[model samples]
Target: MLEVDGLTCRFGTKAAVDNASFSIEPGRFVGVIGRSGAGKSTLLRMINRLETPTSGRILFEGVDVTALQGRDLRRWRARSAMIFQQFNLVGRLDVLTNVLMGRLAGVPLWRSLIQHWPQNDKAVAISALEQFDMMPMAAQRADQLSGGQQQRVAIARAIVQQPDIILADEPIASLDPRNTRIVMDALLRINKHFGITVICNLHSLDLARTYCDRLIGMSAGRIVFDGAPAALTDSIARELYDLEAGEVMDDAPDFVPGELTPAFGNVAA
Candidate 1:
């Protein structure tokens, strides 16, 4: 569904993303893993057009995303949602209202200006909240929710956008272990049930292996590994992280997703 070719982003003289190239198949849950400043986030941002590439081409369903400008760029952004490490919710607004903001691309200007969402848009937002068992808290202030809940709200907001793909940049880096499990499960559910292709930048190899079907590893601003979870052997893992084999395999968390909170089955139905 998306292809990035010879992508490069330089800040002054230093390259943040140096000639990185990859492709994402439709509905694939892909994880980009790397250390700090490895260019994982920059790669996703360039694909989403949040950062302009110094030189390269990004194609979404064969559309030249790098060439998009004005309304065209706005349309592309609307179709490709971005979730951040910090839940980017308006702390003062009601949760449902924040979710409704996703419809800004499709809603008329007058309604958006007045913050008056149409009934259909309201229904969509409500349904999205329900997926995460958050319908009851629709009217609560965003700042009042827990970090996990806030992250779920952010996911709902992304869902309400009706995006085909979600680019999550370290979406769980700020959460506790329990909240990390919840957020990761929610993202997996979205990918499995809703068929939204997810490209997540994960710090934990265990989380990436548990949730992503494919793993793309980066080091020094270039792809070092790309393959299935099973293919990410000890040697490759060490190489990807620039560590010895003994130092790399001992840190993965062992969380099982046997019972999904809010019940992914019910959400799908």
Candidate 2:
């Protein structure tokens, strides 16, 4: 279990994440939903230690995550992989090599510098690519792949990290509708199939309702709601988004509970 006790981040006088607190059990698929600047990204970054917190504690299995340093911090990061909105792959590197980068923390420094990956690591990278149906593009440059394909490659890289949890920050924000379904499905599969905990920041209420087992709603850097998706009533949603009912409906016209957008095409192979 992961415990976030009164976590907070302040930039000068402004608090980006203000006294946020939550707990996540292993293998749970969670969505953090809020409007822009609500500090959803900051919360995830703080958990990953990409952003330093001003107060409170983050504990993982009885260990204080906030106090970790140097090698320990690096090891913690290795265990908790992060996926970003923009697919952050090396543009010039081959797909396989990019995935193999996940193993850098565990490998000897000289071996990684020389690109001398162990056979077992190679096999793991290949297996991750195959799982995402990107094995055929293993030798292709990351920049050459389509947005959807690149995101898939990014996910494959995360998988090869063998992370206990994945922190996805608006992962599908830039993808087309078709690719959104594909990437979201891939995340769902990773959670259910491999039992990896997934904490995702999402802008689309439809997608959050459809994919997440639990939802954490934020407004102006504060956590306002936390419950199962079904419990998130229309009125609560309006408060979370700080919008009128009509505006909420206008934003999510196709939001049928437990269903993805019907217009999305099949997953690309």
CA shift of 232, model 2, Å: 0.6
Q: List residue ranges in candidate 2 displaced over 4 A.
A: 244-269
Candidate 2: tens digits of C-alpha lDDT, residues 102-172: 89888999999899999999999999998778899999999999999999889888888899999999999
Candidate 2 lDDT score at position 15: 92
Q: Residue 102, candidate 1: how far off, in angstroms? A: 0.9
- The deviation in Å at residue 112 for candidate 2 is 1.4
**Model 1 per-residue lDDT at 197:** 97
TM-score of each: 0.94, 0.92
| CA RMSD (A), model 1 | 2.0
List the global CA lDDT of all models.
0.87, 0.87
Q: Write the per-residue lDDT of candidate 1 for residues 144-223, one digit (tens) a residue.
A: 99999999999999999999999999999889877887888888888888899999998778778888999999988888
Clashing pairs in 1: none
